[model samples]
Target: MYEYKCVELRSKMFGGALSGDKLERVLNEWAAKGWQLKSTAAVDVKGRIGPGGTDGLLITFERQKG
Candidate 1:
């Protein structure tokens, strides 16, 4: 049988305005689940760390062969 899975990390300008370090942490955790950072997307809401703005990120994880 074939199995498939996915993980998504979203921070709507909360968690202290998501930073690369924090994002990396999320990526690392998911990485353990065989997930890797694939891509990311974001939009300006109002402002953020530098300026409150909305943001979105996409991560892709896939099973590997042994």
Candidate 2:
């Protein structure tokens, strides 16, 4: 069996550009905890002060649950 996790990566730039450095950091952090990236999906995520959503990525990870 395995466990799965979903993480949202939001763009901090004004022009809606995703940070590569941040992405690498998150991937490494989760990998250190035994999680491997399974998939990703581009999405528009709702923000705290926004009427519409912003561009973001939905990252999925999986790990053995034994």
Candidate 1 per-residue lDDT over residues 4-34, each given as its tens digit: 4444445653464678888777778877876
At residue 36, candidate 1 shows an lDDT of: 47
- Tell me the tens digit of each residue's lDDT in model 2 across 2-51: 99999988785425666777788889999999999999999888877959
- Estimated TM-score for each candidate: 0.49, 0.82
For model 2, what is the alpha-carbon lDDT of residue 29? 100
Candidate 1: list runs displaced more than 4 Å: 1-8, 43-54
The whole-model C-alpha lDDT of candidate 2 against the native structure comes to 0.86
Candidates in order have lDDT scores of 0.57, 0.86
- Clash count for candidate 2 is 0
Candidate 2 has its poorest 10 consecutive residues by lDDT at 12-21
